[model samples]
Target: MICFNIIQLFVILKLCSGMRYIDLKSNFISDGVEVQHGYFMTSGKYKMFHARDPALEVIQFGETRVFPDVDYTPGTHSLFVEQFKVGDEEALSIYVFRMSVTSNSVVYKVYFHMSEFGYKLIDCAKFTELIKGKIHVSLDLSKSKSHPFFNIHTKEEHGQSTTLIEIRKSIAGFRLRNVEAKRYEFGRIMDSSFPIYMGYSKLNMFLTKATSIFIHKEDNRKYIVLRHWTKNIRFDLMTVNGILAWNAITDPEPSLLEDMHQKVFRLRDRIDGYRALNPLSTLDLAENISPELLGIEKVTGRHGGSTYALYHLEIGKEAYNKIKFVVNSEMLDMLIAKIDDRTLYAKVEVITNSQRTFLIITCLMKIDLVYETVINYYDKPNMENTSYYHVPEPYQTKIVSDMYKKYPVLINMDIDNPPSIVDHGELQYDSYILKYFRIKQEDGRGSVLSGKYAFGDIWQKDLHEIGNIPYEGNKRRLKVIAHSVNSSRIIVKPKNMEYPLLPEELQDYVIIDG
Candidate 1:
């Protein structure tokens, strides 16, 4: 009991004496690398310490040190420190700590810091994770483009990157996951999902891509008002003009901040609501958390009379069909004009709000697009047994010999080397398409008459519909005329050099691009 009292007294005095400064963790005396506490800089002071050693207190995430000296106000401070150990070189380090307090302890969290000239490669990480193990060694490949053991070459072709890794498994020094979430920003993006999220409890604002910082006089605190469009009214990171970072408390707006919190939780409620929904049986499941999304295409359209994105998302196993994604924030809707949606893998659930239901992406963790099957499908498919198209009917053998000359680009494809259309005949499955067909003949030189799917996505049969679709701001699209599936659906150009049929009403309309 007496020992406990002394320790308590010392802690109380440390807090009350206004000595709210932490001595930098000693280099050797501090706790060495342990998964949970490895990254936490140990607390201590040494005789070898320089005057600027106190600045190292800021090099933490989670709950920052309760240091009274290190200013959390906006602006960058450059500190140069000599080697922590004797006879070692110096380093330039600046670390940003995220704030989160647990049981009076400053929880060491994520970190992004600059080093002198080389990476401080540690074999172990500061946090616990099963997927990634840390790398112990450092490489000087930047100085000289050579590795003693491994040969790495990168090739870029047609907007795609391919890397050949021939290294032996004996190389335990190389990490399976080069980056982990608890240590940095990048690994999560590559291994997890995009729009990496981090929250700060010290202030009532979200900071990302900050622009300008403002310091208030009466409060003498750093305050940032961010404007975000990605979600939760994503506020663009607030930064100061000419200066990089600013941290201040929006102390005056307690009620306003509470209201904002209410709004944020409301979004969270919507997310939970989405997860409760039973996903489509047709869609591939994502470990039952949600339906998997194979890819994303951003569409600009009007929603509720206002401009927003109607995301055209690719569902599992189907490439041509699409599912729509709704936004969690109006701010994200506002950014519809600016967003450039990349082809990414995502998982989403359906939510019902305002008597309407839609799918929304709620992240657990996202993976990269799996395209091996797609690549192989193109290279290995037997075209004869698939849904294929070609020049339909009498146009298959007509005066259209000159059609190729008239529109070389339009008539291009494997026109002469046609594949026999698929005949399922009696095969049964979950689903199958009923399409028209004809057997291909290996007779003469390939010509525009021989049919194949390669020529183009749009055919002249769709010309009438395409020619009359309404312009922007109009929701109307083409409505194809009904026809029996047994009969082929193609129109001979000009009916022997004349015009094709159109809906009686649109006879006056003419296609502009055509």
Candidate 2:
């Protein structure tokens, strides 16, 4: 490919009382190779111009003309101006003349040489003749213009020197000496039976673009119409108060929720809602307990065998102040107790203003619990973990370092690994490891410890083993052991651990069975 950094070109148009100008800069790179030789038209009117190096002095003018009736032979022509000094006068001449075509098949001859003028007219007819059987001619008038300074300024004579007008034109002058014939063939036409326009509003101006659609036929007499366009389609239906603006399509708004609701109702006519009846008698007891008493108004219950239940508590607004103080104290206690772990993952949240405080609890299996903690920002928050026991700045580093020491296996995964839920025995976690390495840092007390560890693993061995495990072993196969630490916190630990019997050291290992 040939890269060309084109300088700016300006065209000034003058009207009766106003003037307008157009500025343009073009960049192009040509492969110097052709696929299906043809003629192409420029988007706007333009003329080709040539200039000498250094001073960019213009010396000649010409235009390119194509004769499509000629054979479709594709190639490139590179020509540059050669200049010289003519005894007290600056004389310009052609420097290089080269034409490259397919297969190294080229012919040439010198037609005329003006030795006194320091120029020669090379015969391009022989070269054109060779490709006459397979040439496609295209016209290019981009080079037909007077030089930049031509006729614009008065010429001044400086003792015994004569000025010459520089000409700028297309090099199609070669066409006058050589001729080739070619033809054109049209391609397949595009289908037009589809939505033609899409509209969007920004501030006040309405922007639109051409769109396409597809139609599909269904069973007996039904049909489906699909609109294919950019996903970011938004329209402002109305704007009021300069604060609330409703933006949506006027037609029926598409919604996955509505479709899911309809599907659920169609499955069973007697079902009122999608919730299963709570079998544990504590369902009503959960609602009676005040959020202040429980620390949080939420608790998880289990059928004690397999199934689990989540309880949510609601209180009136009158109890807000009392519950707020009590909940805060409980939260502080939970936070302090969690400080011993290398990394603390918990949620201490309270929704205020309502008369009644509400608490929500969700029951999670071991794998679900661990996976959520490692990947979920809400659980393993990025908040600064500082305390009066240590300097605030290095608290996060200390916690992360301690976490690695306690769970060294988790740090071995490369940082570049693809995003996914990975299960190793009782522990399930999501890791994004692309690169692997380790770093060490010291605390304010001067205790050196390894900090950051990143790595990537492409093998998906655990996924395959889990998929093939028998039902009998899988039933008793616990992935994790989860425990509720308090009203707002839960902790999960992997129960299975095993060492591979391989001779070489195991690069990465996951607990598969307890």
* Candidate number of the best TM-score: 1
Query: 233 in model 1: Cα distance from truth in Å?
Result: 28
Error of 1 at 141 (Å): 17
lDDT of 2 by residue, 403-473 (tens): 35532112122112321112222212332112222223321122232322222122221321122221111
lDDT of each: 0.25, 0.22
Predicted candidate 1 versus true structure: per-residue lDDT over 433-499, tens digit per residue:
1222222232121212233211221222231112222111111233222211122122212222234
Clashes of 2: 45
Estimated TM-score for each candidate = 0.16, 0.16
